[model samples]
Target: MANKLIKQMGLPKSIANIFTARNIITAKDALSHTEFELMELLDVDKEEVTSAMAHVSEVVCPPCQTALLLLEQRVRNETLAGHLPTHLKGLDEALCGGIPFGVLTELVGPAGIGKTQFCLKLSLLASLPASCGGLDGRVIYIDIESKFRSKRLIEIGINSFPEIFLKKGMAQEMAGRILVLRPTSLSEFAESLYQIKVSLLQQQVKLLIIDSMAALVLGEHECGTSRQQALGVHVSFIKSLAEFSRIPVILTNQVRSQFGDESRMYSFQEPLYNKR
Candidate 1:
């Protein structure tokens, strides 16, 4: 029966033998060859391809494993990952260490905690020369709060690299790399963000900033069923896009109050109100 099932599933005889010995219930329960199905089987979310190689004998494929090895190498190459500073030395150092290449890092805090400043600083930082943090990469700044300030960025840029502004050629080059985007509505904002991400990658954008994500959510509607649903969609959209781009997505968020508990006297709320 196992032999018949294995033949039907088109698996190699040697691979099928291993399953048959374990008395594997059926081929239906085994891994699939489709891309999505293979992704599910590998549990790429729970564990990385590199970690899986630690126990190569346990995994099901030689060809698939080889493909994963190549994929893993590519990811490692792109990541060129770095560490977060121990002192939390503001945004410059925190990101100076490096933001996860293909992950969403939320900057949630109170009104005056420098969230916008961080985003602006990151844009300028990414635009700097090799001597600075720049990888010859550009930045895409999405202004949701209507608080995108050019003056503030200029101030930070001057502080971080006075020589650039002092030198017209360098300043012109750095200024050209930044792309400021302002979307009037939530839908427009989302569409623009998607396009900007795609476009920026072509220009080798290492950093993308969405200033005050909650503003767009709250601007469209108050916290309600519709708003909740929309926010969820936005979160998922950003997460997916972040993974695809393999670039740092620094998003600012707003805060809200929460009800207090019986045991704890303090009443705190989640600053970043996204469902996840």
Candidate 2:
């Protein structure tokens, strides 16, 4: 009966036979083996590994194996998949026709550039009806520096969709769909990430906005530590989680003037983008 699950997944019979020969026990256990990892176990050549990968893709839905061809297909899928529109014509056009689902988009600028306002707008716009250009799904807003503005969210909602929210309690329902998190420091942000990993998927969070990604690491940089490297780890974790869950993460970052250069600026020493 366990073998039936493998067969139902559209994998070849020989692959199942190979697993049984190795005493792999069940398809669940066998599924964990990558094509490269399976070489020693199966005593197989590269061609056999390719064949195993093909079988693996049958059960994995999207293939776990990374190849140039697979990556091209993944990019194609991302472009074709439905995206969350920010509901502004020019901004949407600038953001590749709306924020692409399943990736991180960094909004970097100096102070007073409306990053928080944009985030608030996104949270409100994310919950509107599809006819009015919204995802109709919940949002996860991770605020740092005490900057998640609910009053602004309400104003944006009431202004953008007066007809919808005016119909009694719809405003609160819209507000309820936005799940807000205030993480004061780096450790708190990390803890919040763990708590939200499953919730994002289970609750169908369509958008994630991290206001001021640099806020948590500010103290570390002041103390002359490896704050850049540390920030990379944090951003990488958030990026992978966002990508894996197919949710678009909007991160707000603060810019710093390059030391001794006095001409150029960089975002968190380039670790946030370059390393990841």
Candidate 3:
């Protein structure tokens, strides 16, 4: 039965026999172990183990689909995997709606450029009802710089959507939907991310905003390669979270003038994974 199941997964007879010899009778049995454990148990190389695991996963829990099929599925579900509008007419039009879901959107500029304000507006919009041009979901705001103020957000909400904010108990209700976490150190920030992952499963989170990535890094580490490496890990994890949850993630970054040419400015520090 084990050999037959493995064969059905498109593995060769030799591979099936190896699994049987190792007492991995079912796909679940094989998948129960990590890739490294599988490699050691079956005495196969990394690629072989990876390929075998991919095959098993493909059969067990499939998510792959062609472009047309994905579109059809979205249509059937009546939920288009689209962007979340920022509600700024010019910016929304430039983005063809708004900040895209399942990707990282970075806001880089010098101090007092309204990055935090923009993020707060987005958080408010994300918490609003679908009828009010929102995702009708919650927001997880990782406020590294401690710049997230409830009062300011409420002001933005009042100005942007007076009809909704003017309603009785509406401001508190909207405020309840945005959960903020302030992690002072890098380690705490990473742990907060793990907690956010669990929260995502338990909540209808539509947007995530990290206000000022530069402050978090600069506060902990000095200017050097170590800072870049640490930031890269966090950025990669955040990217994965956005893709996994199928939500929009916004990150704000600070800028500094060039060393020689003070007229020109660039991001204070670029993450190692940053291509730009």
Q: Each model's TM-score?
A: 0.63, 0.67, 0.67
Tell me the tens digit of each residue's lDDT in model 1 across 136-158. 58888888767877777777777
**Candidate 1 CA-lDDT value:** 0.61
Q: Which lDDT tens digits does candidate 2 get at residues 1-276?
A: 234344455556776577658876555666678767777787777787677666655655643566666656655666786567777788766555577677777887777888898888888777876676788889989888788778878888888778987889988989999988888778888999888898887998888888876767775476434776777888888888877888777888765555575633235323242111
Model 1 residue-pair collision total: 0
lDDT of 2: 0.73
Reference-based lDDT, each prediction: 0.61, 0.73, 0.80
Per-residue lDDT tens digits of candidate 3, residues 104-198? 77887778989899899999989999988888999999898788899999999999999999999999999999999988888888899998998
Error of 3 at 242 (Å): 0.8
Which residue runs does candidate 3 get wrong by more than 4 Å?
1-80, 257-276
Q: Please name the candidate that would achieve the greatest lDDT relative to the true structure.
A: 3
TM-score of 1: 0.63
What's the C-alpha lDDT at position 116 in model 3?
91
